[model samples]
Target chain A: MTTTEAPAPSASVIARRLVSLHGLTRLVLFAGFWLVFAGNDPQSWIIGAPAVLLASWTAERLSRRRGRDVTLGGLLRYIPFFLWESILGGTDVAKRVMRPEVDIAPGLIEYKIRLTEPGARVFFLDSISLLPGTLSADYRDGIAYVHALDADEDLLDPLRRLELRVADLFGERLGGEPDA
Target chain B: MNILLDLLSVLLILAGAFFFIAGTVGLLRLPDLFTRLHALTKADNLGLGLIMLGCVRFAPDGLYIAKMLLLWLLIMASGATASHLIAKRALRGDGEDY
Candidate 1:
C-alpha cells in the first residue's frame, strides 16, 4: 500500500549503491558470523576473511529483493511476541495430538497480504507455519494460501494480527483494513 | 545457584523431550501430509527451543550460549522454509506417493 513512489534510479547508480551499501553490510554481517564460529584465533582469520568475503559476494549476487530497513526497536518488540506465540503454538498442537481421540479439521485458507515488501511477505509465509495450526502453502497475486489444521476456527483474526506485527517489524504501513 | 540451574535445566529438557514425543505421535496419527507437517513444526520450534534454552542455563561462556542460540535460529529458519516447500509441493499434487 505504498503510494507516491520515488523515481527509479539508473542501473549503474543502483549497482553502485547495492555494492557500496548492501555489499558492505553483508560483508560486516558475514564477518560477524565468522568471528562467532572461529573465535579470536589469528590463524583462523587467514582463511575466514576470504571465506567471509566470498559469502558476502555470493549473498549479494543471489539476493532477489532489495534490503529493507528493519527497526531495532521493532525487532526488540517482535521477539517477545514471536517467542510467546511460538510457545503457545507448540503447546496447542501438542495438546491436540495427545488427546485420546485425535481430532483435526484440516483445510486451506487464503489470506490477503497487506504488506508491500516482498521480503516481508516471505517472512509472513515462513512465520505462518510456526504459529498455531497454520502452514503457508503458497502465495499468488498478493494472497497467501495457508493450510490450516482447523479450518473451522476463525483464522483471519490471527493472520491479521501477525501481518500487523510483521509490518511493524519492517516499519511499513499497511493499507487500511479492507472488509474482512 | 548451580544446583538451581541444574534442576531447571533438567525440567526444561524433560519438557522438551515430551514435546518431541508428542510431535512424532501426531506425525504418525495425522490424517494427511499437511497435518503431519503441522505436527513436525511444533517439534522444530518449541521442542528444540526448550532444549537450547535448557542448554543455555548452564552454558560455560558467552560464546557457548551465543552458539546455542545461533543453532536454534538456523534450525527454525530451515525448518519453516522446508515445511512451506513441502506443503506447496503436496498442494500441487507433485508428490502423489503420500
Candidate 2:
C-alpha cells in the first residue's frame, strides 16, 4: 500500500547529512574513527550532540517514508567484522597500488537494495566508496553505481560479504530471491 | 634506552614545531585559501602525528602510547573533516581563495 510521496525542504539536507554520518567504512580504516573524533576535543560531543540531535529525528522520518531504520544494536553488530574487513581493504589497496601489472578496472556498478530507507541506502553507498580500489559513482532509484579499479570477482565478493554483514546487523536480506 | 627515548622525543617535538611554523607561514603568505589549506592541513596533520609519536616514545608502554596516538587520530579526523566542510562552504560563497 505504499504510494509516491511528496518532497519536503529539510528532506534534501537530511538526505545528504545521512550520507555523511552513516558511511563509516572509510573512517573505520583510519582506526577507532568516531572514538578518536570524540577523544580529541572531548568538547566535540557538545556541538556534535545538538547538531546530530536532529539526525535521530530525520532518521526515523526516513524510515517511515522508506520502511527501514537501522537500530543502534543492529548497526553495532557488524563492527567486529567490519574492522576485520577494513584491515583487508587496507592491504588490498596497498597491493594494487604497489603492483605494476594490476591495472584497475574502474567503472560504475549498481547494487540492489533491500532496505526501503533512502538515508540508509545512501549510507551503504558512502561506506563502499571508503574501501580501496572502489569508489561510489552514484546511487539512484535503489541502485548503487560503484566504480572499481579492478572489476573482478574480488571487488564484488567483498561487497557481497559486506552486504551480508550489514544485513545480518539489520536483519534484512540482500541479492536473494523474493519468495512472493 | 631511557636517554635515547628522551632525545628522540626532543627531536620529534622540534621537528613538529618546525613543520607547524612553516604551515602557519604558508597560510599567511599563500595567495589562495585552498592553497593555504593545502599547506596548513598536510603540515598540521603530519606535525601533530610526529608530536604524538614523540610522546608515545616517552610513555611507559605500548597501551598508553596507543591511547595517545588515538587522540592524534581524533584530532586529524575532525580537523580534516572541518577543513573540508569549511572549504566547500567557502567555495560556494564565491570562494575567498587565500
Candidate 3:
C-alpha cells in the first residue's frame, strides 16, 4: 500500500504567510485572555483553548485577506483626534441640553472620504460613529455620509484631524497637508 | 488577603454602579439620540467592565477569571459595534448628528 503524505501543516503556512508579529501579538493577547479565564479549571481550559484558537484563526484569516497593518504607536497618535472629537461632541450635547433651540443641523453630510483602503475607510467611519454627534450613513467610492448634530465651525478642525488620523492608520498620505 | 480583595472588590463594584447610574441618567436626560448614545455607550461599557473585573476576584481559579475577562472584552467589542450600527442608522435617517 502506498503511504499518503500528510499536508504537513501548510494550512498554517498559507494562513500565516502574510501574518505579522503585531497580528500575532493580538492573537497571543486573546489566547492569554482565554487561558486566564479558564484559570485553574482544567475542564474549562480544554474548551477555552479551542475557542481562543478559533478567534485567533479568524483574526489571522481576516488580516491576511485584507493585508491591513496598524501599529500601536500609530494608533496612539490618533487618540488626541478622537478625544478632541469626543469633547466637541460633548459640548454640542451640552448645548442641546441647555438650549432647546440650539441649531441642530440634522442632515447627512456627504463627506468624501479621502482614505483609499476600503478596510481603513470603514474603520474610520466606524470610529467616527463611536464618538458622539458623528454617524456614518453609507460609504461609496471613498465617501462617507456623515450625519452631524450641529453644523458649526468648531467641528471643522476636529473633523480634519480625524480624517488625517484615519488616513495615517490606513498608511496613506492622501496628497494633502496633515490635519492641523 | 481575602479581606483586602473583598474591600477592593466592593469599591470597584460601587464605582461601576455609579457609572451605570450616570449612564442611565444621560440616557434619560440627553436631548438627542447621538448624545444619548455617547453617555450610554462609554459609561455603561466602562461600568460593566469595572464591575466584571471586581466580580472576577471571586472566581475560584485563573481560568474562570480569564473567561470573565474575555467576556468583558467581547462586551466592549460588541458594544462598540452595536453602538456604531445604531448610530449609523440614526444618522442615515433624518436624526441630527450634533
Top candidate when judged by TM-score against the true structure: 1
B1-98, model 2: which lDDT tens digit per residue?
98987998999887677667756665665455444544455556556766777777667765566677677656655654454445545644645664
Instruction: List candidate 3 segments past 4 Å from native.
Output: A1-23, A40-44, A62-64, A79-95, A98-103, A176-180, B1-77, B87-98
In angstroms, the error of model 3 at B73 is 5.8
lDDT of 3 at A62: 48
Evaluated on the second chain alone, the candidates' TM-scores are: 0.89, 0.81, 0.88
The true-structure Cα RMSD of candidate 3 reads 8.5
Candidate 2 CAPRI assessment class: incorrect
Q: Which stretches of candidate 2 lie over 4 Å from their true place?
A: A1-68, A100-102, A171-180, B1-98
For model 2 chain A, the run of ten residues with the poorest summed lDDT? A23-32
TM-score of each prediction:
0.90, 0.45, 0.62
Error of 2 at A66 (Å): 8.2
Runs off by more than 4 Å, candidate 1: A1-15, A18-21, A176-180, B96-98
- Per-prediction DockQ comes to 0.77, 0.06, 0.22
lDDT of 3 at B54: 88
Model 3 C-alpha lDDT per residue in residues A1-180, reported as the tens digit of each score: 011234343466636642667656766787677666545556876788778777777655544334456767777887666656544444444445445444455555667666666566666766765455665555555566665655553554555667778878767778644332
Ordered from best to worst TM-score, the candidate numbers read: 1, 3, 2
Arrange candidates, best DockQ first. Answer: 1, 3, 2
- Model 1 reaches what TM-score against the true structure? 0.90
